[model samples]
Target: MVTIETPRSPRNRKSAQREKQAWLFMRASGVVLIVLIFGHLFINLFSGNGIKAIDFAFVAGKWANPLWKIWDTLMLWLALIHGTNGMRTLVNDYTQREGIRKFLNIALWTICIALIILGTLVTTTFDPCPDTSVASALPQFCK
Candidate 1:
């Protein structure tokens, strides 16, 4: 018969500097996330006509202004990156298989990159009233 001992908790071999930097990043990102989340909510859910104010025209109006465009772009990138990083941390902590962990991390980052690119493009270049040299009856505003 053989007896096996359970493995001890993983030890931190990282240097103090590296550990400190990681800690700092987590804290900073967390703080920024709070601000971003709240501000986004306040803007989208409380301002103007509230959620009902969200229309193609409203989006176009927002992008027409540079400030809203910047705000949206920042929010998109920050939220995606922050959420991805947090998920990465969770996966790292809980995942026991190296192969699965690597695959999940790759997938997470890939999706984040793809979404960020697509979202940024959409927000920056969205046109509510598409260019139609001809006339059409859709929304009077679009016409």
Candidate 2:
């Protein structure tokens, strides 16, 4: 026989609504991630000159454009948050200890926020022209 635990309070209803929203978000973000991830791989690894073409200048050139910057930023933020939420769900389900589950979730969010902040800074603040020792082979923008 299967047992179903029923919610007994109004707070449970609010939690149920949030849970539904999270489920929807997971589905939507997953679909978006498929496109974003595949497009990212194809563009970075298959298009243009291919894998051998990736270098500091390649990254700098790519981030120089606001379009690619936004693409990458969206990809990073979506993937991180989606992954964090999934992990939180898992922890809530699997961990029997409330204290342990809470600690894990707190750690997950802290790491997620830190990564998002760092990634956004890197994506948006990237400068195509940076002072390098090898000025001879530098892109014209750097010269």
Candidate 3:
């Protein structure tokens, strides 16, 4: 006979609380992501020369602004975290083997962290104007 856990039980309560928090986070992050994504699309596609204006120089010019940098960084961080969390929920639900589940979770987090670090570095340290003898190769904004 299977026994059902009581809602008031300490163990059940803790698990329930964690699940509740995760659920709330998913909803909050999803809403924020929608706003961020739409804003990004509007700026990149509708403004200036429209989609045709997007080139290496366009990206370099945008990142030159601290505001854009912050906006993009926030978007990157949120997107990665949101995706990782969703994947984690799937892994938890579908994986039956403890060893495999643990491995998959660890792998997922490790990959997410690596990508976040790489993306943050690229966004923060990006220099559109680099010292080079080939001036013609640089974006027009750099010249």
Question: lDDT for every model?
Answer: 0.78, 0.89, 0.88
Clash pairs, candidate 3, are none
Candidates arranged by lDDT, highest first: 2, 3, 1
- Model 3: weakest 10-residue lDDT segment is 4-13
- Evaluate model 2: give its lDDT: 0.89
Error of 2 at 13 (Å): 0.8
lDDT of 3 at 87: 96
TM-score for predicted model 1 compared with the true structure: 0.76
> What lDDT score is found at residue 59 in candidate 3?
88
- Backbone clashes in model 1, listed as residue pairs: none
- Predicted candidate 2 versus true structure: per-residue lDDT over 29-91, tens digit per residue: 999999999999999998889998888888877877888999999999999999999999899
Q: For residue 142, give model 2's deviation from the true position in Å.
A: 1.1
Displacement of residue 43 (Cα, Å) in model 1 is: 2.2
Better of 1 and 3 by lDDT: 3
Number of clashing pairs per prediction, in order: 0, 0, 0
26-130: candidate 3 lDDT, tens digit per residue:
999999999999999999988677988887678888988899999999999999998998999899878889899999999999999999999999999998887
lDDT by residue for model 1 (17-118), tens:
664676687788788878877887887789778998776666766677788888888878988887888898788778999999999999999999999999
Q: What is the lDDT of residue 133 in candidate 1?
A: 62
The lDDT of model 3 is 0.88
